[model samples]
Target: MGDVGPYPWLRAVLAAFAEEVRGLGPVLDVGCGPGEVTAHLAGLGVDVSGVDLSPKMVEHARRLHPRLRFAVASATDLDLEPGSLGGILGWWSLFNLPREVLPEVLASFACALVPGGHALIGTHVGAGDVPRTEAYGGVPVTWTTHLWQPGELGELIVAAGLELTAQLQLPASGQLRPQVLISARRAPEIAPGR
Candidate 1:
Protein backbone atom coordinates (compact mmCIF):
# COMPACT_ATOMS: atom_id res chain seq x y z
CA MET A 1 0.00 0.00 0.00
CA GLY A 2 0.96 3.69 -0.28
CA ASP A 3 3.08 3.14 -3.36
CA VAL A 4 5.59 1.05 -1.40
CA GLY A 5 5.85 -1.10 -4.50
CA PRO A 6 5.66 -4.84 -4.98
CA TYR A 7 8.31 -7.49 -4.49
CA PRO A 8 10.93 -7.41 -7.26
CA TRP A 9 9.85 -10.62 -8.95
CA LEU A 10 6.22 -9.70 -8.64
CA ARG A 11 6.85 -6.28 -10.07
CA ALA A 12 8.79 -7.65 -13.01
CA VAL A 13 6.15 -10.28 -13.75
CA LEU A 14 3.26 -7.78 -13.63
CA ALA A 15 5.11 -5.30 -15.81
CA ALA A 16 5.70 -7.97 -18.41
CA PHE A 17 2.03 -8.93 -18.43
CA ALA A 18 0.96 -5.30 -18.54
CA GLU A 19 3.11 -4.80 -21.61
CA GLU A 20 1.12 -7.52 -23.36
CA VAL A 21 -2.03 -5.38 -23.26
CA ARG A 22 -0.34 -1.99 -23.60
CA GLY A 23 -2.11 -0.53 -26.62
CA LEU A 24 -5.41 -2.34 -26.28
CA GLY A 25 -7.01 0.22 -23.94
CA PRO A 26 -7.05 1.40 -20.36
CA VAL A 27 -6.25 -1.06 -17.56
CA LEU A 28 -8.44 -1.05 -14.47
CA ASP A 29 -6.50 -1.48 -11.24
CA VAL A 30 -9.22 -3.05 -9.11
CA GLY A 31 -8.71 -2.56 -5.38
CA CYS A 32 -5.85 -0.27 -6.14
CA GLY A 33 -5.24 0.46 -2.44
CA PRO A 34 -2.76 3.34 -2.69
CA GLY A 35 -2.04 3.43 -6.43
CA GLU A 36 1.36 1.81 -6.12
CA VAL A 37 0.90 -0.77 -8.86
CA THR A 38 -1.39 1.53 -10.82
CA ALA A 39 1.39 4.08 -10.95
CA HIS A 40 3.79 1.34 -11.96
CA LEU A 41 1.69 0.43 -15.00
CA ALA A 42 1.26 4.06 -15.96
CA GLY A 43 5.05 4.45 -15.87
CA LEU A 44 5.24 1.53 -18.29
CA GLY A 45 3.29 3.55 -20.91
CA VAL A 46 0.03 1.70 -20.39
CA ASP A 47 -3.23 3.63 -20.06
CA VAL A 48 -4.38 2.89 -16.51
CA SER A 49 -6.97 3.83 -13.88
CA GLY A 50 -7.55 2.86 -10.24
CA VAL A 51 -10.71 1.68 -8.55
CA ASP A 52 -11.27 0.69 -4.92
CA LEU A 53 -14.34 0.26 -2.75
CA SER A 54 -13.02 2.57 -0.03
CA PRO A 55 -13.25 6.28 -0.62
CA LYS A 56 -10.35 6.88 1.73
CA MET A 57 -8.17 4.58 -0.30
CA VAL A 58 -9.27 6.26 -3.51
CA GLU A 59 -8.49 9.63 -1.95
CA HIS A 60 -5.02 8.48 -1.02
CA ALA A 61 -4.47 7.13 -4.53
CA ARG A 62 -5.71 10.38 -6.07
CA ARG A 63 -3.34 12.35 -3.89
CA LEU A 64 -0.46 10.09 -4.73
CA HIS A 65 -1.11 10.12 -8.47
CA PRO A 66 -3.14 13.26 -9.11
CA ARG A 67 -2.84 13.08 -12.87
CA LEU A 68 -4.21 9.53 -12.98
CA ARG A 69 -7.83 8.50 -12.49
CA PHE A 70 -9.02 6.81 -9.30
CA ALA A 71 -12.63 5.86 -8.51
CA VAL A 72 -14.43 4.35 -5.56
CA ALA A 73 -16.18 1.26 -6.87
CA SER A 74 -16.82 -2.35 -6.06
CA ALA A 75 -15.36 -5.15 -8.10
CA THR A 76 -18.49 -7.26 -7.54
CA ASP A 77 -20.54 -4.64 -9.38
CA LEU A 78 -18.48 -2.46 -11.68
CA ASP A 79 -19.98 0.60 -13.39
CA LEU A 80 -18.05 0.03 -16.60
CA GLU A 81 -19.83 -0.60 -19.89
CA PRO A 82 -19.54 -4.07 -21.30
CA GLY A 83 -16.53 -4.65 -23.52
CA SER A 84 -14.95 -1.40 -22.46
CA LEU A 85 -11.66 -2.23 -20.71
CA GLY A 86 -8.47 -3.69 -22.08
CA GLY A 87 -7.12 -5.22 -18.89
CA ILE A 88 -7.70 -5.68 -15.16
CA LEU A 89 -5.33 -5.97 -12.19
CA GLY A 90 -6.84 -7.66 -9.17
CA TRP A 91 -3.64 -7.84 -7.20
CA TRP A 92 -3.85 -9.12 -3.62
CA SER A 93 -7.48 -8.04 -3.44
CA LEU A 94 -9.85 -10.82 -4.49
CA PHE A 95 -8.98 -12.97 -1.49
CA ASN A 96 -10.60 -10.39 0.75
CA LEU A 97 -14.00 -11.41 -0.61
CA PRO A 98 -15.93 -14.45 0.42
CA ARG A 99 -15.57 -17.44 -1.84
CA GLU A 100 -19.22 -17.26 -2.90
CA VAL A 101 -18.70 -13.66 -4.04
CA LEU A 102 -15.79 -14.42 -6.35
CA PRO A 103 -17.74 -15.74 -9.31
CA GLU A 104 -19.94 -12.65 -9.49
CA VAL A 105 -16.90 -10.36 -9.27
CA LEU A 106 -15.05 -12.40 -11.85
CA ALA A 107 -18.06 -12.19 -14.15
CA SER A 108 -18.15 -8.46 -13.69
CA PHE A 109 -14.46 -8.27 -14.59
CA ALA A 110 -15.05 -10.28 -17.73
CA CYS A 111 -17.99 -8.11 -18.75
CA ALA A 112 -15.96 -4.94 -18.38
CA LEU A 113 -13.38 -6.04 -20.92
CA VAL A 114 -12.96 -5.82 -24.68
CA PRO A 115 -12.42 -8.99 -26.64
CA GLY A 116 -8.85 -10.16 -25.96
CA GLY A 117 -8.72 -8.08 -22.78
CA HIS A 118 -6.39 -9.48 -20.14
CA ALA A 119 -6.53 -9.84 -16.34
CA LEU A 120 -3.88 -10.56 -13.75
CA ILE A 121 -5.25 -11.77 -10.42
CA GLY A 122 -3.18 -12.43 -7.28
CA THR A 123 -4.10 -14.02 -3.95
CA HIS A 124 -2.69 -15.99 -1.02
CA VAL A 125 -2.47 -19.76 -1.07
CA GLY A 126 -4.20 -21.90 1.55
CA ALA A 127 -7.45 -23.68 2.35
CA GLY A 128 -9.74 -21.35 4.33
CA ASP A 129 -10.44 -17.77 5.16
CA VAL A 130 -8.61 -16.33 8.15
CA PRO A 131 -9.79 -13.37 10.13
CA ARG A 132 -7.32 -10.88 11.55
CA THR A 133 -8.16 -8.49 14.37
CA GLU A 134 -4.85 -6.72 14.80
CA ALA A 135 -2.54 -4.97 12.38
CA TYR A 136 1.12 -5.78 11.97
CA GLY A 137 2.36 -2.20 12.23
CA GLY A 138 0.28 -1.41 15.35
CA VAL A 139 -2.54 0.15 13.35
CA PRO A 140 -6.02 -1.06 14.21
CA VAL A 141 -7.61 -3.24 11.54
CA THR A 142 -10.41 -5.73 11.01
CA TRP A 143 -10.65 -8.04 8.02
CA THR A 144 -10.59 -11.60 6.93
CA THR A 145 -7.97 -12.78 4.47
CA HIS A 146 -9.21 -15.67 2.38
CA LEU A 147 -6.95 -18.20 0.73
CA TRP A 148 -7.44 -20.61 -2.16
CA GLN A 149 -5.79 -23.30 -4.17
CA PRO A 150 -4.49 -22.02 -7.51
CA GLY A 151 -6.56 -24.52 -9.46
CA GLU A 152 -9.77 -23.52 -7.68
CA LEU A 153 -9.37 -19.84 -8.48
CA GLY A 154 -8.35 -20.62 -12.04
CA GLU A 155 -11.51 -22.64 -12.52
CA LEU A 156 -13.60 -19.69 -11.35
CA ILE A 157 -11.82 -17.33 -13.74
CA VAL A 158 -12.35 -19.70 -16.65
CA ALA A 159 -16.02 -20.11 -15.79
CA ALA A 160 -16.42 -16.35 -15.91
CA GLY A 161 -15.79 -16.32 -19.71
CA LEU A 162 -12.08 -15.59 -19.71
CA GLU A 163 -9.50 -18.13 -20.79
CA LEU A 164 -6.79 -18.87 -18.26
CA THR A 165 -3.45 -18.11 -19.88
CA ALA A 166 -1.09 -18.92 -17.01
CA GLN A 167 -0.95 -19.60 -13.29
CA LEU A 168 2.09 -19.22 -11.02
CA GLN A 169 2.33 -20.63 -7.51
CA LEU A 170 5.18 -18.91 -5.79
CA PRO A 171 6.74 -20.31 -2.64
CA ALA A 172 6.91 -18.17 0.43
CA SER A 173 10.05 -16.07 0.63
CA GLY A 174 11.43 -13.78 3.29
CA GLN A 175 8.49 -11.95 4.88
CA LEU A 176 6.15 -12.47 1.97
CA ARG A 177 3.28 -14.90 2.00
CA PRO A 178 3.06 -17.68 -0.53
CA GLN A 179 0.89 -16.48 -3.41
CA VAL A 180 -0.93 -17.53 -6.53
CA LEU A 181 -0.78 -15.28 -9.56
CA ILE A 182 -3.19 -15.94 -12.42
CA SER A 183 -3.35 -14.39 -15.87
CA ALA A 184 -6.33 -14.72 -18.17
CA ARG A 185 -7.58 -13.23 -21.40
CA ARG A 186 -11.00 -12.64 -22.91
CA ALA A 187 -11.31 -14.64 -26.10
CA PRO A 188 -10.46 -12.55 -29.15
CA GLU A 189 -12.36 -12.69 -32.41
CA ILE A 190 -10.97 -14.62 -35.35
CA ALA A 191 -10.39 -12.78 -38.58
CA PRO A 192 -11.74 -13.98 -41.94
CA GLY A 193 -8.57 -15.70 -43.04
CA ARG A 194 -6.90 -19.05 -43.21
Candidate 2:
Protein backbone atom coordinates (compact mmCIF):
# COMPACT_ATOMS: atom_id res chain seq x y z
CA MET A 1 0.00 0.00 0.00
CA GLY A 2 3.04 2.16 -0.21
CA ASP A 3 5.05 3.03 -3.29
CA VAL A 4 7.89 0.55 -3.67
CA GLY A 5 11.01 0.81 -5.78
CA PRO A 6 12.04 -1.86 -8.22
CA TYR A 7 14.78 -3.81 -6.49
CA PRO A 8 18.20 -2.56 -7.63
CA TRP A 9 19.11 -5.79 -9.38
CA LEU A 10 15.63 -6.11 -10.81
CA ARG A 11 16.00 -2.68 -12.32
CA ALA A 12 19.25 -3.68 -13.95
CA VAL A 13 17.78 -6.90 -15.24
CA LEU A 14 14.79 -5.07 -16.72
CA ALA A 15 17.06 -2.52 -18.30
CA ALA A 16 19.04 -5.30 -19.90
CA PHE A 17 15.83 -6.91 -21.16
CA ALA A 18 14.86 -3.65 -22.81
CA GLU A 19 18.24 -3.31 -24.44
CA GLU A 20 18.14 -6.78 -25.92
CA VAL A 21 14.52 -6.77 -27.09
CA ARG A 22 14.21 -5.02 -30.45
CA GLY A 23 11.12 -3.39 -31.96
CA LEU A 24 9.25 -3.08 -28.67
CA GLY A 25 7.00 -0.06 -28.76
CA PRO A 26 4.50 1.74 -26.61
CA VAL A 27 4.36 -0.47 -23.53
CA LEU A 28 1.45 -1.50 -21.34
CA ASP A 29 2.24 -1.69 -17.65
CA VAL A 30 -0.27 -4.05 -16.04
CA GLY A 31 -0.72 -3.67 -12.32
CA CYS A 32 1.12 -0.44 -12.80
CA GLY A 33 0.86 0.92 -9.26
CA PRO A 34 1.02 4.70 -9.49
CA GLY A 35 2.81 4.11 -12.80
CA GLU A 36 6.41 4.09 -11.57
CA VAL A 37 7.60 1.41 -13.93
CA THR A 38 5.56 3.00 -16.69
CA ALA A 39 7.26 6.30 -15.97
CA HIS A 40 10.61 4.54 -15.90
CA LEU A 41 9.95 2.94 -19.29
CA ALA A 42 8.84 6.28 -20.68
CA GLY A 43 12.05 7.79 -19.38
CA LEU A 44 13.92 5.08 -21.23
CA GLY A 45 12.38 6.58 -24.42
CA VAL A 46 9.88 3.82 -24.99
CA ASP A 47 6.34 5.10 -25.54
CA VAL A 48 4.14 3.88 -22.67
CA SER A 49 0.51 3.24 -21.80
CA GLY A 50 -0.65 1.71 -18.53
CA VAL A 51 -3.64 -0.06 -17.04
CA ASP A 52 -4.49 -0.70 -13.40
CA LEU A 53 -7.67 -1.86 -11.66
CA SER A 54 -7.72 0.81 -8.99
CA PRO A 55 -9.30 4.09 -9.97
CA LYS A 56 -7.72 5.95 -7.07
CA MET A 57 -4.35 4.47 -7.88
CA VAL A 58 -4.91 5.22 -11.54
CA GLU A 59 -5.89 8.75 -10.64
CA HIS A 60 -2.80 9.14 -8.54
CA ALA A 61 -0.74 7.78 -11.41
CA ARG A 62 -2.40 10.15 -13.89
CA ARG A 63 -1.60 13.09 -11.67
CA LEU A 64 2.03 12.12 -11.29
CA HIS A 65 2.51 10.90 -14.87
CA PRO A 66 0.20 12.89 -17.08
CA ARG A 67 2.52 12.51 -20.01
CA LEU A 68 1.85 8.78 -20.25
CA ARG A 69 -1.41 7.06 -21.18
CA PHE A 70 -3.33 5.10 -18.52
CA ALA A 71 -6.73 3.68 -17.77
CA VAL A 72 -8.70 1.87 -15.08
CA ALA A 73 -9.20 -1.60 -16.50
CA SER A 74 -8.89 -5.25 -15.64
CA ALA A 75 -5.83 -7.17 -16.86
CA THR A 76 -8.24 -9.97 -17.76
CA ASP A 77 -10.08 -7.59 -20.05
CA LEU A 78 -7.89 -4.84 -21.51
CA ASP A 79 -9.86 -2.45 -23.70
CA LEU A 80 -7.06 -1.91 -26.20
CA GLU A 81 -7.31 -3.19 -29.74
CA PRO A 82 -5.53 -6.37 -30.75
CA GLY A 83 -1.91 -6.14 -31.91
CA SER A 84 -1.62 -2.65 -30.49
CA LEU A 85 0.93 -3.11 -27.74
CA GLY A 86 4.66 -3.78 -27.83
CA GLY A 87 4.89 -5.16 -24.30
CA ILE A 88 3.19 -5.63 -20.92
CA LEU A 89 4.52 -5.48 -17.36
CA GLY A 90 2.33 -7.43 -14.97
CA TRP A 91 4.09 -6.63 -11.76
CA TRP A 92 2.42 -8.28 -8.79
CA SER A 93 -1.07 -8.13 -10.24
CA LEU A 94 -2.13 -11.63 -11.13
CA PHE A 95 -1.80 -12.65 -7.50
CA ASN A 96 -5.17 -11.07 -6.94
CA LEU A 97 -6.68 -13.14 -9.74
CA PRO A 98 -7.79 -16.62 -8.79
CA ARG A 99 -5.79 -19.50 -10.28
CA GLU A 100 -8.84 -20.48 -12.32
CA VAL A 101 -8.87 -17.02 -13.81
CA LEU A 102 -5.11 -16.70 -14.35
CA PRO A 103 -5.16 -18.29 -17.77
CA GLU A 104 -7.91 -16.03 -19.05
CA VAL A 105 -6.10 -13.05 -17.63
CA LEU A 106 -2.97 -14.09 -19.49
CA ALA A 107 -4.90 -14.77 -22.65
CA SER A 108 -6.19 -11.22 -22.48
CA PHE A 109 -2.62 -10.00 -22.09
CA ALA A 110 -1.64 -11.96 -25.18
CA CYS A 111 -4.55 -10.58 -27.19
CA ALA A 112 -3.47 -7.01 -26.45
CA LEU A 113 -0.07 -7.41 -28.06
CA VAL A 114 1.31 -7.72 -31.56
CA PRO A 115 3.45 -10.64 -32.55
CA GLY A 116 6.97 -10.37 -31.10
CA GLY A 117 5.70 -8.33 -28.20
CA HIS A 118 7.02 -8.82 -24.68
CA ALA A 119 5.63 -9.20 -21.15
CA LEU A 120 7.32 -9.28 -17.76
CA ILE A 121 5.24 -10.78 -14.93
CA GLY A 122 6.16 -10.56 -11.23
CA THR A 123 4.85 -12.73 -8.39
CA HIS A 124 5.63 -13.90 -4.88
CA VAL A 125 7.32 -17.25 -4.22
CA GLY A 126 4.48 -18.76 -2.19
CA ALA A 127 1.68 -16.42 -1.13
CA GLY A 128 -1.68 -15.56 -2.55
CA ASP A 129 -3.54 -12.27 -2.15
CA VAL A 130 -3.16 -10.92 1.33
CA PRO A 131 -6.71 -10.22 2.61
CA ARG A 132 -8.23 -6.78 2.88
CA THR A 133 -7.79 -6.50 6.59
CA GLU A 134 -7.09 -2.82 6.09
CA ALA A 135 -7.15 -0.01 3.58
CA TYR A 136 -4.38 1.95 1.92
CA GLY A 137 -4.63 5.70 1.54
CA GLY A 138 -8.36 5.58 2.29
CA VAL A 139 -9.13 2.94 -0.30
CA PRO A 140 -10.50 -0.35 0.97
CA VAL A 141 -9.31 -3.24 -1.14
CA THR A 142 -8.78 -7.00 -1.00
CA TRP A 143 -5.92 -9.03 -2.40
CA THR A 144 -6.81 -12.07 -4.55
CA THR A 145 -5.35 -15.36 -5.99
CA HIS A 146 -2.88 -17.94 -4.63
CA LEU A 147 0.81 -18.95 -4.57
CA TRP A 148 2.34 -20.35 -7.76
CA GLN A 149 5.41 -22.49 -8.43
CA PRO A 150 7.92 -21.55 -11.15
CA GLY A 151 6.77 -24.12 -13.68
CA GLU A 152 3.08 -23.36 -13.08
CA LEU A 153 3.56 -19.68 -13.79
CA GLY A 154 5.61 -20.46 -16.87
CA GLU A 155 3.01 -22.89 -18.13
CA LEU A 156 0.24 -20.28 -17.82
CA ILE A 157 2.18 -17.75 -19.89
CA VAL A 158 3.08 -20.32 -22.52
CA ALA A 159 -0.52 -21.47 -22.71
CA ALA A 160 -1.45 -17.89 -23.45
CA GLY A 161 1.05 -18.08 -26.32
CA LEU A 162 3.79 -16.04 -24.76
CA GLU A 163 7.30 -17.49 -24.92
CA LEU A 164 9.18 -18.02 -21.68
CA THR A 165 12.31 -15.91 -21.37
CA ALA A 166 13.52 -15.95 -17.78
CA GLN A 167 12.59 -16.17 -14.12
CA LEU A 168 14.26 -14.12 -11.42
CA GLN A 169 13.52 -14.09 -7.71
CA LEU A 170 14.46 -11.29 -5.38
CA PRO A 171 14.33 -11.04 -1.63
CA ALA A 172 11.18 -9.57 -0.10
CA SER A 173 11.12 -6.12 1.33
CA GLY A 174 12.49 -5.56 4.86
CA GLN A 175 13.68 -9.18 4.80
CA LEU A 176 15.81 -11.63 2.87
CA ARG A 177 13.02 -14.08 2.03
CA PRO A 178 12.64 -14.78 -1.72
CA GLN A 179 10.02 -13.54 -4.16
CA VAL A 180 9.45 -15.19 -7.53
CA LEU A 181 9.57 -13.17 -10.73
CA ILE A 182 8.63 -14.22 -14.25
CA SER A 183 9.61 -12.59 -17.55
CA ALA A 184 8.15 -13.58 -20.93
CA ARG A 185 7.61 -12.50 -24.53
CA ARG A 186 4.92 -13.16 -27.12
CA ALA A 187 6.29 -14.89 -30.21
CA PRO A 188 5.34 -13.95 -33.75
CA GLU A 189 4.02 -16.32 -36.33
CA ILE A 190 6.55 -18.05 -38.58
CA ALA A 191 6.58 -16.21 -41.86
CA PRO A 192 5.99 -18.00 -45.15
CA GLY A 193 9.45 -17.15 -46.48
CA ARG A 194 11.10 -18.78 -43.53
Candidate 3:
Protein backbone atom coordinates (compact mmCIF):
# COMPACT_ATOMS: atom_id res chain seq x y z
CA MET A 1 0.00 0.00 0.00
CA GLY A 2 1.93 2.94 -1.29
CA ASP A 3 0.95 6.52 -0.54
CA VAL A 4 -2.45 6.85 -2.19
CA GLY A 5 -3.30 10.56 -2.02
CA PRO A 6 -2.48 12.64 1.02
CA TYR A 7 0.12 10.23 2.39
CA PRO A 8 3.04 12.35 1.34
CA TRP A 9 1.43 15.32 3.02
CA LEU A 10 0.89 13.24 6.11
CA ARG A 11 4.54 12.27 6.16
CA ALA A 12 5.55 15.85 5.70
CA VAL A 13 3.47 16.83 8.69
CA LEU A 14 5.23 14.25 10.82
CA ALA A 15 8.60 15.40 9.61
CA ALA A 16 7.70 18.97 10.57
CA PHE A 17 6.91 17.95 14.15
CA ALA A 18 10.06 15.86 14.63
CA GLU A 19 11.36 18.34 17.14
CA GLU A 20 8.47 17.73 19.56
CA VAL A 21 9.33 14.04 19.65
CA ARG A 22 13.02 14.69 19.92
CA GLY A 23 12.58 16.88 22.96
CA LEU A 24 10.51 14.44 25.00
CA GLY A 25 12.05 10.98 24.46
CA PRO A 26 11.53 7.87 22.33
CA VAL A 27 8.64 7.60 19.88
CA LEU A 28 6.10 4.82 19.38
CA ASP A 29 4.39 4.13 16.09
CA VAL A 30 1.11 2.53 17.10
CA GLY A 31 -0.73 0.48 14.53
CA CYS A 32 2.53 0.46 12.63
CA GLY A 33 1.50 -2.06 9.96
CA PRO A 34 4.75 -2.54 8.04
CA GLY A 35 6.90 -0.04 9.94
CA GLU A 36 7.38 2.35 7.05
CA VAL A 37 6.60 5.41 9.15
CA THR A 38 8.53 3.96 12.08
CA ALA A 39 11.54 3.50 9.84
CA HIS A 40 11.18 7.07 8.66
CA LEU A 41 11.27 8.28 12.26
CA ALA A 42 14.27 6.08 12.95
CA GLY A 43 15.95 7.51 9.88
CA LEU A 44 15.50 10.95 11.39
CA GLY A 45 17.43 9.71 14.45
CA VAL A 46 14.34 9.55 16.64
CA ASP A 47 14.42 6.62 19.06
CA VAL A 48 11.33 4.86 17.73
CA SER A 49 9.49 1.55 18.11
CA GLY A 50 6.77 -0.04 15.99
CA VAL A 51 3.78 -1.99 17.27
CA ASP A 52 1.03 -3.77 15.34
CA LEU A 53 -1.67 -6.24 16.28
CA SER A 54 -0.62 -8.74 13.63
CA PRO A 55 2.42 -10.85 14.24
CA LYS A 56 2.89 -11.22 10.50
CA MET A 57 3.14 -7.46 10.16
CA VAL A 58 5.65 -7.39 12.99
CA GLU A 59 7.75 -10.06 11.31
CA HIS A 60 7.56 -8.24 8.01
CA ALA A 61 8.55 -4.97 9.68
CA ARG A 62 11.51 -6.62 11.36
CA ARG A 63 12.61 -8.06 8.05
CA LEU A 64 12.15 -4.75 6.28
CA HIS A 65 13.88 -2.68 8.95
CA PRO A 66 16.03 -4.97 10.99
CA ARG A 67 17.63 -2.25 13.10
CA LEU A 68 14.34 -0.77 14.31
CA ARG A 69 12.23 -2.31 17.07
CA PHE A 70 8.91 -3.94 16.20
CA ALA A 71 6.33 -5.72 18.33
CA VAL A 72 2.87 -7.26 18.04
CA ALA A 73 0.60 -5.24 20.24
CA SER A 74 -2.89 -3.75 20.23
CA ALA A 75 -3.34 -0.01 20.16
CA THR A 76 -6.09 -0.04 22.75
CA ASP A 77 -3.87 -1.86 25.19
CA LEU A 78 -0.22 -0.85 25.02
CA ASP A 79 2.68 -2.41 26.89
CA LEU A 80 4.42 0.84 27.69
CA GLU A 81 5.43 2.72 30.79
CA PRO A 82 3.49 5.86 31.64
CA GLY A 83 5.14 9.12 30.63
CA SER A 84 7.66 7.21 28.57
CA LEU A 85 7.19 8.00 24.89
CA GLY A 86 7.88 11.35 23.27
CA GLY A 87 5.76 11.03 20.15
CA ILE A 88 3.29 8.70 18.46
CA LEU A 89 2.26 8.19 14.86
CA GLY A 90 -1.08 6.62 14.05
CA TRP A 91 -0.91 7.28 10.35
CA TRP A 92 -3.76 5.83 8.32
CA SER A 93 -4.56 3.54 11.24
CA LEU A 94 -7.15 5.13 13.52
CA PHE A 95 -10.01 4.91 11.03
CA ASN A 96 -9.83 1.11 11.24
CA LEU A 97 -11.13 1.20 14.79
CA PRO A 98 -14.75 1.36 15.94
CA ARG A 99 -15.88 4.66 17.38
CA GLU A 100 -16.53 3.24 20.83
CA VAL A 101 -12.90 2.21 21.19
CA LEU A 102 -11.26 5.44 20.13
CA PRO A 103 -11.37 7.05 23.53
CA GLU A 104 -9.62 4.12 25.15
CA VAL A 105 -6.95 4.00 22.50
CA LEU A 106 -6.45 7.75 22.51
CA ALA A 107 -6.13 7.65 26.27
CA SER A 108 -3.53 4.97 25.91
CA PHE A 109 -1.64 7.21 23.53
CA ALA A 110 -1.76 9.94 26.12
CA CYS A 111 -0.64 7.58 28.86
CA ALA A 112 2.33 6.40 26.86
CA LEU A 113 3.54 9.95 26.27
CA VAL A 114 5.54 12.13 28.60
CA PRO A 115 4.26 15.55 29.56
CA GLY A 116 4.66 17.76 26.47
CA GLY A 117 4.88 14.75 24.13
CA HIS A 118 3.31 14.96 20.67
CA ALA A 119 1.04 12.73 18.55
CA LEU A 120 0.06 12.78 14.91
CA ILE A 121 -3.18 10.94 14.02
CA GLY A 122 -4.48 10.49 10.49
CA THR A 123 -7.87 9.36 9.20
CA HIS A 124 -10.46 9.78 6.48
CA VAL A 125 -12.95 12.58 7.01
CA GLY A 126 -16.58 11.55 6.75
CA ALA A 127 -19.71 10.87 8.76
CA GLY A 128 -19.65 7.24 9.93
CA ASP A 129 -18.36 3.70 9.48
CA VAL A 130 -17.57 2.26 6.07
CA PRO A 131 -17.37 -1.50 5.64
CA ARG A 132 -15.36 -2.98 2.83
CA THR A 133 -16.39 -6.56 2.25
CA GLU A 134 -14.56 -7.32 -0.95
CA ALA A 135 -10.85 -7.80 -1.50
CA TYR A 136 -8.56 -5.29 -3.16
CA GLY A 137 -6.07 -5.99 -5.94
CA GLY A 138 -7.02 -9.72 -6.06
CA VAL A 139 -6.08 -10.18 -2.44
CA PRO A 140 -8.65 -11.50 0.02
CA VAL A 141 -9.18 -8.72 2.49
CA THR A 142 -12.05 -7.50 4.67
CA TRP A 143 -11.98 -4.41 6.82
CA THR A 144 -14.06 -1.53 8.13
CA THR A 145 -13.10 2.14 8.11
CA HIS A 146 -14.65 4.50 10.64
CA LEU A 147 -14.57 8.02 9.37
CA TRP A 148 -14.71 11.10 11.58
CA GLN A 149 -15.28 14.81 11.43
CA PRO A 150 -12.28 16.83 12.63
CA GLY A 151 -14.28 18.22 15.52
CA GLU A 152 -15.22 14.74 16.66
CA LEU A 153 -11.64 13.54 16.77
CA GLY A 154 -10.55 16.81 18.36
CA GLU A 155 -12.96 16.27 21.20
CA LEU A 156 -11.58 12.80 21.77
CA ILE A 157 -8.03 14.13 21.84
CA VAL A 158 -8.96 16.76 24.38
CA ALA A 159 -10.80 14.18 26.44
CA ALA A 160 -7.66 12.08 26.41
CA GLY A 161 -5.75 14.93 28.09
CA LEU A 162 -3.96 16.17 25.00
CA GLU A 163 -4.16 19.72 23.67
CA LEU A 164 -5.11 20.16 20.07
CA THR A 165 -2.24 21.85 18.27
CA ALA A 166 -3.11 21.60 14.59
CA GLN A 167 -5.79 20.09 12.39
CA LEU A 168 -5.07 19.75 8.70
CA GLN A 169 -7.86 18.63 6.36
CA LEU A 170 -6.71 18.05 2.84
CA PRO A 171 -9.36 18.06 0.15
CA ALA A 172 -9.99 14.91 -1.86
CA SER A 173 -8.57 14.45 -5.32
CA GLY A 174 -10.25 11.93 -7.67
CA GLN A 175 -11.21 8.71 -5.88
CA LEU A 176 -9.63 9.48 -2.57
CA ARG A 177 -11.63 10.69 0.41
CA PRO A 178 -10.63 13.89 2.17
CA GLN A 179 -8.10 13.12 4.88
CA VAL A 180 -7.75 14.74 8.30
CA LEU A 181 -4.49 14.92 10.17
CA ILE A 182 -4.53 16.00 13.82
CA SER A 183 -1.49 17.00 15.83
CA ALA A 184 -1.80 17.05 19.59
CA ARG A 185 0.50 17.59 22.53
CA ARG A 186 0.24 16.26 26.05
CA ALA A 187 -0.03 19.09 28.57
CA PRO A 188 3.10 19.85 30.50
CA GLU A 189 3.24 19.07 34.19
CA ILE A 190 2.49 21.86 36.64
CA ALA A 191 3.60 22.39 40.19
CA PRO A 192 0.73 22.61 42.67
CA GLY A 193 -0.37 26.13 43.61
CA ARG A 194 2.04 27.73 41.28
Estimated TM-score per prediction?
Answer: 0.93, 0.85, 0.91
Task: Report the C-alpha lDDT of model 2 over 1-194, residue by residue, as the tens digit.
Answer: 12336467667656755663436666788878788877877766677777888898899899999988888988777766788878777777777787888898788778877788888787766655455544544665556446777787899999998888878876556733356677777787798989
Residue 20 deviation, candidate 2, in Å?
4.8
Which structure among the candidates has the greatest TM-score?
1
- Judge candidate 3 at residue 83 and give its lDDT: 90
Question: Alpha carbon lDDT of residue 139, candidate 1?
Answer: 68
Name the runs in model 2 displaced over 4 angstroms. Answer: 1-6, 20-22, 127-130, 135-140, 172-177
* 2 against 3, candidate with superior lDDT: 3
RMSD of each: 1.8, 2.7, 2.2
Point out where model 1 deviates above 4 Å.
1-6
Q: Model 2 clash pairs? A: 96-144
Clashes of each: 0, 1, 0
What tens-digit string does per-residue lDDT give for candidate 1 at 43-122? Answer: 88989999999899899999989999999998877877898889998988778888889998899889888899999999
Better of 1 and 2 by lDDT: 1
Quote the lDDT for 27 in model 3: 89
Clashing pairs in 3: none
